[model samples]
Target: MKKSIEEIQKEIISEFSDLTDWEEKFQYLIELGEELPAYPEEKRTESYLVPGCQSRVWVCPSLENGELQFYADSDTALTKGLIAILIRVFSGHSPKEIANASLEFIDAIGLSKFLSISRRNGLSSMVNMLQNFAKNSGSEI
Candidate 1:
């Protein structure tokens, strides 16, 4: 069975809790970025780029069999990992769930405290972009 968002969040929190410092978290994020699949050059166009982000961000959300899926990429490595993190949390969720998700869960995971201000802003923008896509696609989120 597919994992629920709560389960995924718990798993992520457990995984990250091993590190005691922000630098280690940053390094872990970078490592996660290294594992992200590269976005095709053809897909890296103005249409996909998310506004309000410091780095070039491309987000695509689609519905398959009533489930939401997200494809995202970013020019910055750390940002890409951020996208990956979002994907882990939001993908396969209902639009309403994604839209209603509180940042508190992220904070609970300790990611918010460790991130730089710019990175936090970027994360907010990324979430906005995903929510926008869901709204446009006729999902409640």
Candidate 2:
């Protein structure tokens, strides 16, 4: 069976636990960004751009085999990693699962306290956009 979102969150938290320094954690996130699947240049149009982030972010959501799949990219590596975390949790999940997901893992990983206020707000915006997609998808399902 597939792991629950909570399990994924816990795993992330555990992974971050090994890196005590903020800089180490920061680098780890950037590494995670590097792991993101290459995003298509053709899809970077305004239609896919996520609003409310200081850095440009593009997200494409699609339904495949009854699961929601997300493809995303960001202008900045840090932001890309942030979105990567969200994608890791929500991708391959049903619309209901995505819509109901919580970002508590951010706190569990001690990330929320360290991010700049603007970054935090941007993260919230990212969540809102993805959740909007999930909610809309749920209605169609």
Candidate 3:
């Protein structure tokens, strides 16, 4: 079975708790990136291209029986994992919940401390894309 968001959050926290430095965080992100599944070339078209990322990203979210599902791909492995993290946080949530989610969750998890300025910006852009999709689709969150 797929892990729940709470479980994933716990795992992330546990995994990163021992790391006291930014370099370790970068290494951790790269390690997480290794776990992401591959994104097909066809999915990397213009419509899915996320603006503000140094790498190409494609995020497709759909609602099934009132639950949101997300599929994402990125040219960069680390970015792909970042996409996965975003999906874990926002997928399956109502649009309103996603839109209302505090950035504090990221900070609480120590993600912001480890992320570079560019990576943080990229993450914000990704979140915006997810929120926009949710709004357009009329999901509750």
Name the best candidate (by TM-score).
2
Clashing pairs in 3: 93-141, 94-140, 94-141, 95-140, 95-141
Over 1-141, each residue of candidate 2 has an lDDT whose tens digit, in order, gives: 998888888889889999979999989988888899999999999999888888999999998987889999999999999999889988988888888888788898877899998898888888999888989985644
Over 1-141, each residue of candidate 3 has an lDDT whose tens digit, in order, gives 856555666666776677887777667776766665666667778888889988778987778766677788887878887887778767776666666665445776666776789988898899899878877777354
Error of 1 at 103 (Å): 3.6
If scored against the real structure, what TM-score would every candidate get?
Answer: 0.87, 0.95, 0.78
Best lDDT goes to which candidate?
A: 2
* Model 3 lDDT, residue 120, Cα: 83
Q: What are the per-residue Cα lDDT tens digits for candidate 1 across 30-72?
A: 7877776766678788888888788888987779766688887
**CA displacement after TM-score superposition, residue 137 of candidate 1 (Å):** 1.5
Candidate 2, residue 64: how far the Cα is off, in Å:
0.6
Candidate 1 clash pair list: 95-141
